[model samples]
Target: MMLLLMLIADLLILSVHGWIVYKTTKIECFPNARYIRNATCGIKAVNRYRSHTNMESDIVNKLRNVSLNLQIFLRNSANKFKPFLVNVTANLCSILDKRNFPAYTTIVMNILKEVSNVNHSCPFTHPLSTHQQKRLIVKNLYMDEKFMPIVPPLGLYKIDFNFLEGYPYDDVGTVILYIQVTDVKEFKLRTKAPKFVYSTIIYKTLSIECKYNPEILTNVTCQLKPINWQKSVCIWDADIPHSLKNISIHLQLFKIYGANNFLPFLINTTLNMCDVLSKRSFSVYGKILFTILKETSNINHQCPHEEHLSLYNLYVDARLVPVTLPLGIYKAVVRFLEGYPQVFIGTTVLNLEAMEKRERRGKVNKN
Candidate 1:
């Protein structure tokens, strides 16, 4: 009975040992509680990765669109007053090394200028992308100061984001700014003659355009005006009679001037001597007399202040030449007649010295 019991115990012990080994192998081969947990975690990780990939794909698409818009802006503003083309480029590195992704998924652009080699950051913030991701990162970019003055007076500007050094790509992206400067114009009255005179009717049209914004051509405003009426051509009084009532119908005072304060006044008068002597045929008989007087009775008696006009028979005209006098207010009296006795038909007064003094004062004040 003891030998039979020992054989049975040995068989039971071997079966138990084999059964433990089988159970451990079955736990490893088939799904257990720990295997189920690991599978569930793996599924979640795969879904997260898919979602991240989709987000990156979207960002890349949007950046491409940005590049297109930038090109359009540059094309439209190409004709503007830009001295030269300003080109800037930078690299947008991926923050995640495992996958090529932007460190700062949210792209921001800023324009800046430097002062004495020191960079002064701009206040404007340009948003290039708005996609959100699992990780956020940022990179610092340095802008060269040489590009600061390349902007045109009016037109759109574009900032290019290059992924491959200086080459442009849709994945890297771009920024744009549409700037329109103001326009203006100005007008003033002027004279055709070297010196303006109230009696003269000759005028010249003066138009001035503002140069502040040369790029914008439409909607210009006239903001400038003549500051001094005396310096303008339209300073003559409108109420003054167009025709001098007492002046002779045959003789008209065409012009009165001097050799820039060095010579005597040359008073030119237009007369119908040509028409009058056209009938006379051979010779025209007429005499013109003129006299000069000073305001302060400070006449230089030695000066030849009185003279008879010279008759230019070729043109049927006459002129009065008065000797030069001291710088002061003065006037000239002119008379025209036809007969030997000299009939006084008309007379004119010239204030050349007075006008000269006024002009001199104006220049002094201007200086």
Candidate 2:
């Protein structure tokens, strides 16, 4: 009886262990190898939150290059997006959304981990410092014509800045801006460089003096505070403000979708801004540039005729045809919408037709 009882006990223990391994690691346990194979893989599953910090300058530069091209591509597609996608193990977005995909999910989650660690090592003490791109990791603050969140796609966010002097672009006195977010939720940042050299990244920061106007951020100055990065996205744990009502912000990001051109259009933006918020286009990033096509002319457009296109709804960017293009992919970045909230925000209301040219232009005219 004692021998029989021992065998039963051993079998029960083995069954429980197998169950534990299954949940910890979703992969199936192999016969006679449950304890062996599963344990190795199980560690990875258990440590989904696991990430390594990479501050090495060379690695950081490689990441930045990838980021730059991503932003430009994204801009032509949508209006806004988050910068680096962090928070591994968590589904960053809704699975039900059409944009969601399994492959993209895996690829981005890994990039999030890699870039977050690298950015945490921001080397330069000054945001305007040489070879240093001022990181723009602010609480998201923009609303679309529908008053929807303008979160950008592919996690690409725009800093919307010109290079400042004493920096790389000193000759032009224009400041080029870029930003990176970390994975873990803390306040210290780190960086590594070539030449086997190590350096600490620091920044002196400004505070949100008043929270009353989250969207109406203006006339305030951000002196970079020497900061240590934590896994948390904010610097010095400085809390980011959220929009209460409709707000006006320069750093705007929206998802880019090739199928939806109207969604990107910002209509009567100057008057809308002035009338709605008593503000004008304040983006130092450059004027709002957009590509326009005509609705009636069998070409992509704001409207069919001159009266409607010129008088009421015209592409604010002087370069846009507001008349016609050669029938190819183009962009439309409306400078400022004046009578904003009170009035309609996009060209949607006009019910324009599409020229939807495929090969008219190979690339956007950068001029």
Q: How accurate is candidate 2 locally (lDDT)?
A: 0.21
All candidates' lDDT scores? Answer: 0.21, 0.21
Task: Compose the digit string of candidate 2's lDDT tens values, residues 282-342.
Answer: 2212122211223111222221111111222232232321222122222332222212453
Residue-pair clashes per candidate, as listed? 4, 69
Q: Which 10 successive residues of model 1 have the least lDDT summed? A: 19-28
RMSD of 1: 40.9
Q: Which parts of model 1 are misplaced by more than 4 Å?
A: 1-83, 92-151, 156-177, 183-367
Model 2: CA > 4 A from native: 1-110, 113-272, 275-280, 284-367
Judged by TM-score, which candidate is best?
2
Count of backbone collisions in candidate 1: 4
What are the TM-scores, per candidate, against the unseen true structure?
A: 0.16, 0.20
Question: lDDT per residue, candidate 1, 1-367, as tens digits?
Answer: 0111111111111101101100000000111221011110000112210110000112122121111111112324346432112222223222111122121111221211111110112111123434332111121112222222111222232232222212343222211222222111111122232321222111111322222122212233322234342222111111111211222212222222363332222222333332322232111122222111111122213222222221111110112221112233333434433333434433333332322213334345644
**Residue 330's C-alpha lDDT in candidate 2?**
29
